[model samples]
Target: MAMDSRRTHRESAVVVGGGISGLLAARELAMKGLRVTLVEKRSHLGGAVGAHEVDGHVLDSGAESFATRTSDVAELLTELGIEDKICSPYDGGSWLYLQDGAHPAPRTGILGIPGDLSDPSIREILSSAGLRRAKMDKLLPASVGANAKTLGELVRKRMGQQVVDRLVAPVTTGVQSTHPDEVEIESVIPGLQAALAQRGSLAAASASLRAASPAGSQVAGLVGGMNQLSEALVRDVLRRRVRILTGYDAIAVDRDPDRGGWTLLQRAPQLGERVAPVHGKYLVMATDAPTTLRILGSHLDASTIPQVKAGHEIALVTLAIEQPELDSRPRGTGLLVSDQVATVRAKALTHATAKWKWIAEEMGPGKHVVRLSYGRGNDHGPLREVSLYDDQLITLAMHDAGKLLGVSITRGNLLGADVVRWKGSLPTMRPGHREKVQQFRNSLQDLEGVTAVGAWLSGNGLAAVTADTRRTMHEFIDATSAD
Candidate 1:
């Protein structure tokens, strides 16, 4: 029973990027029986989450794991029935690498926000004054609490600067490439904002956040790599016959000019000279921020996304080190970079096996795997300067991890390391980013089939992008499906 392709009323969707958001969007739309085509510029799918096996060790392009509290991702996994495939961070423990190397985080801190900086447990990372300021969180006004603000301001207002420079910056930057001075608190630390606005005090907020953190709790990831999730997602919908085009770069999306269905001109990555125009009833641009802006052209105006220059961000450099000495038995997850402190050297290291316990638990034996990652900030340029040589990275990682753990590292041996740098990671959502976000949102109404989705909305990291993508999909579905 072949279907006619010429049916005027045929339903279809073209997801312009093969990133996680794009994958999710395609899955959801395909499940609803809409003809779906996922177009990715990369020859390989899984935008930033690409994964491969190099010499029997799993290598990932981005964060090896994803946080689970955002039920949107969890719900999606459950719906796809791959919920069992993802594993959580080891509840037994996790470590945060500091200036020295690797050290156990305080058992009571909230997302690295100290429950009591005074507690001798974290005194090594804070001063006496800082500890006292931790108690002053109740005084800040709640109105601007959730508003865009720098991590420095957030801590200086609610806790203190010492805490900001030490634990928060070093750890949080592992996820965001910008510094505390640049990383919007609202974007990076959503818990703090919610605590201040909803719960009304820093202490109350800390308690609320502490309870939700992956620390000493189960965190999650796919078996091979985080990209496996994306692959699985794509595979699920493919059985339903969703069209997928890989290695094709969508150049521009606009009206056909002559006929009227939206047209997308794309050049396959390798076959660049072969540019072909694609048309669809509706188009979902699941591209990165810059490209989305480029495609918007005149369609971009005050009515849609803001004119503000999207903050330049840096892609991450992940080093997979097979060090038995530095690596513990697969138990918990890894560490992060405090963007401000990330110098010419290493950023931070979070244990992958530790972060996702399933990967570690199932290992045969004598295989101690760890993901040593460094985030080159937006401040750095040309990537080569920030890029790390295998030995150089190993040295810096050891220093950074040693600083956190407050110990010498003679144990783990170095496996191989790889680097993939995405120049435009996301916009830096400074305080007042929400206002810009409003402007960005308004810009979309004027565009017929284009919908922008990325971490740029939050201007900080990927977790927000996941939640926002879920919301954006609904918005697109509503807009495109309406009469």
Candidate 2:
């Protein structure tokens, strides 16, 4: 081991980034008997799927659920021996807070797109004129918006602007952290284009997609928290004898001419820390888009590299309120605020205790945990108008929660509160994002023993990320083994 100071680590991998993807990549390499050294800039791992303690209860600080469109996350959980922990949120449903008032979210739909146009909730959200306009989607030619690049265009052209503005915009922005105009329809809603063509109508196509999807809740969570997946991944990778270095930021990457591998220059998060060099036969850049591109740009043509802009900066305020009124789940699981709602600054709110039965049982009676998310797809959202300090943000959360949920949650009722902010954690997959990522990956072909994988390449959600990371690892393994 000491001799590695002079020579490159032969038959080894150096994975930069300790997120779920990086950890999975390291595990895959380790399973193949390749020595793995994973480096993370943060002191703790898990990246966005992290955990925090609020009022003595440890909960997921980032992503709390995974889409059930695919079994990728479920399979991974099963592999990690946590299959029995899978649980769906209570079937109480969710709500959308608009300028007028709170309305029940449309059922039988995906991403707030109502598959059943006759749903009462859908009618309530759209005006009579708006509903008439939306009905024209059935009469319009399927080709009207079939080739539309953005989700906004497709929905607007076929289903009317009201559908896009009232229905799709809030859900898309809240979930993807980006505007529908910037989102690629194919990437976000796979097979939607073909479905539209086949069904000859937008509503029918949405219904077809929903029908084909796995029955039951569209999302699922672990018994403990979604962060358990990260914990399980770290444990499995460690068991595989993978080496993990925390608080180590990779500053530069270079191709080792002598060994025909790769070498990485790393530094600690703290200033004046000593620099360290790591080398391996295989290199995985699993950080955010900008950081990954920065490291790989050293070996590839900088001009051809796609510049992935920083995503929305989100600040989450979790409030542990002693409110018995929320026991009935006033707004169901929570509410997604519409952009037109000038009264509320928070974009979304999750009644944690109401959403997850396990959390409710853990907290006991008369106590509730509410989480409010402050941020929007665009930079000019309400979050920008408010200050982000812990006290200030919590004050805003308390105010918004009371209004959105139709309950009174004063500072006296606030038992415990904390603010968690994620900067550039979400990747904005705008139209043509897939192509740009492909071009970036292709640009790395000339550089041997290197590959990149993350949410930037895969679309949003745990399913896309988990599936893509494993697939990339297999590809890398096969390509290298062939050599």
Candidate 3:
């Protein structure tokens, strides 16, 4: 492919999403000397990584931490001059709410897969029969689950239905926002399948991955909150003179027929505002999969549009309460609930104060911040009804929090509360999603100036998005600069 010979002023790029990925993309392009423009439909810049205030104290309403599996997020923070503020979660362990009761989550595994089955805590969650079945993974043939596509199929073949339902399902739902049966093993845990083939067992493979992971905590957050990363990124991008447009929803995208660049059509923010055509030499689509595909599909082949499942709508309720009983942190950090647990409608609960010492210190003694997340995988069942109203959701959250934490949190104890609903913020990676995403990327080979980057293309979470966005932007920069 070659650039149009008659073109002029080709050193410009337009980013279509203002989340972390989009912000990072703009920063990279600006560093490469390309004037950049970023557009976000929401008035806010950080999509899921935004802040909210409760009782005069500011806190993160969505993601609070980033995985330390990779150094991308930390490296980015360091570049932005806020790495000193990075902090780790308190040593208190997390818990899992099972059908029988709450039990300590497995300490030495990825996504709830136990590395060492001999741990005494394993017995508390798995029955004697279940433990016996799980131990069979070591005895099973290495090829048993090696070819399985989904995480559920692989785990179920090597371990058992009990392990999949009780252990893996909850972790997947809580972390990836999808069932193990739906998510691809390659997408979630990249090296597990190959490690299984080499180590001869899922348990040993998990141990291998955990051993390879960075020491200290698997996740870390800023002293204030994860939202600070977004704030810092936005500040840096603007300092670089990147033009940011909020409340402008992109409706269509196509290659510029007149000049061989790219053109985007954004819907006006208000009734009286006029819609304008934004033109750039390069384009980056960082929105969710559906919206990204809808725009890109206009220029690509029909086969290139992946048949992906729409992301689930998640509602988070953060409560500020005065509970002395929770000061000791009985549940530690919070609990991930098994879908089979009939007592609660919320998928997971985060003891925000217990998880971060900074948050606890800011709130003073006896004050706590607890957040309950509603919605898991594709099913909404109880959550669909409860999430319809803020009061209904908050009331349910109070009851569920009390039950999960084993402490009383009542309206009388509640000092302040907030509810934030995120629709299509987190992608649900289905089976073969990894391959489909790769194919979608390949579909854009003809349009060398356009790139797609986000959680939908990269695997979910801050680590994946950060690392993938940098690589994507670098590739585009290298290719275009060569011209």
Candidate 4:
């Protein structure tokens, strides 16, 4: 059913974003017997967690899996009735491509930080001198790098620069699209410092954390695709009668003093020269940091508005190839390329068919799917690559795929190819990002019935976003109920 032609009168909650976080928030509000309206600027609901069709095959365009460090995402999947579809990647471990060459990544590690420095693979990637420096992490006192702010700082102080450049840099750049120097140690690995303090060694702490996690792959995805999670959330929220307004952008927001609620000024092409006012007793700003600040800036004090760094512009090039050599899975699931490697432009590549059995089965024999990601946070050189024409990017991806996979792949072998670009979707969590987020959240306490949640605040990955959204919504529900 279409929304009413005029302004909505005082809904119990208004979620200004239709991403996963916003959808989950709307669902939570509706479940608590509150009328909710979900507004999204894009025509589609899911933000980064979306799907695209390439070569007659539907694939996840953004996030494809969730971390299993916590059961938060798994439990949510169970509630959504798709838990049975959860599947793991093949047992083939990933690889790392450094300036030297390609080598298998350490089997037991977190974010490329080897849990056991004695692992033979570590010797293959690091020089004898580098390995000697890394082993010093075990000898160093726990308090040596205790107060280090960034992950790069902590690792360099504990291990060495070689380890940071060759090991950690590839993983951080591949996964987060940001360098380790810009990543907060605590934000990415919670309780790591405390663990370091207790274990008296960084390597020991990493091993302990890895051991505590659920057995098998640290990440998992649905049999179909993670896009199903977004679709499922949309379906569930609609069943609860949550009003969903796509293409409706919340341009301005303010407090309704007389009504003791919130008012959002929304504009859309569909509205055509008219702005619609949406009123609600509660508000959830589930947008990216920049857009959220734009709408709520006037209402927040100048000092209270946190300075948020812009996210990187990422372009993913996916290729479906009919390469018989790929049947051997030369590089395992895929390889994370070090930024220092001048030979390859892509920071990472995932052998989709080799990584996911379902995808392999869908493609049948002799057909393979590979995805290459291009972009590094705050790096304009890579931004230029992502800004290239679709055909140009596809050609570049094909070259990079051939180099990384050790296979001769040409256009003749390429059955189909596509490029998907995402802007400001993967937020960069700088060294002090978590502290700034906390300060910003504290400032919102003065604004009654208003809260904020997203990757910018909760850190990256589906697990962090899902867990944080549910927890924040539950808290909001409790606070609103008490009043």
Local accuracy of candidate 1 as per-residue lDDT tens digits, 1-483: 112344445576678888777877776676555787778887666666777554356656665666655665667667777777766556645555555544556666554676654566576656677776666766666664455367766666677777777766765555554567766666655657766678776666676777776354424666666776667777886887878888787788878778665788899757756998777766777777677767766566635555545544333334444455444433234555455444424555555555554555544343344445554454455453345555565566556545543334443543444555555554566667778777777767766666666666634334556778878877777666674
- Give all candidates' CA lDDT scores: 0.62, 0.86, 0.87, 0.88
For candidate 2, write residues 229-320 as lDDT tens digits: 99999999999889999888789988788976788999975767879999897899988988988788767887779977777788999999
TM-score of 3: 0.96
Models ranked on lDDT? 4, 3, 2, 1
Q: Each model's TM-score, in the order given?
A: 0.84, 0.96, 0.96, 0.96
**Candidate 4 on 37-107: residue-level lDDT in tens?**
99998888878899998788999999999999899999999999999999998878889998878898887
Instruction: Evaluate model 4: give its TM-score.
Output: 0.96
RMSD of each: 4.3, 3.2, 2.5, 3.5
Candidate 4: pairs in clash: none
Candidate 3 on 348-405: residue-level lDDT in tens? 9999999998999999999999999987766756547335799988999999999999
| Candidate 1 backbone clash number | 43
Provide the lowest-lDDT 10-residue window in model 3.
1-10
Off by over 4 Å in 1: 1-8, 92-103, 138-148, 197-200, 302-304, 307-333, 337-344, 361-365, 378-385, 388-412, 458-463
lDDT of 3 at 13: 83
Give, for candidate 4, the lowest lDDT window spanning 10 residues. 1-10
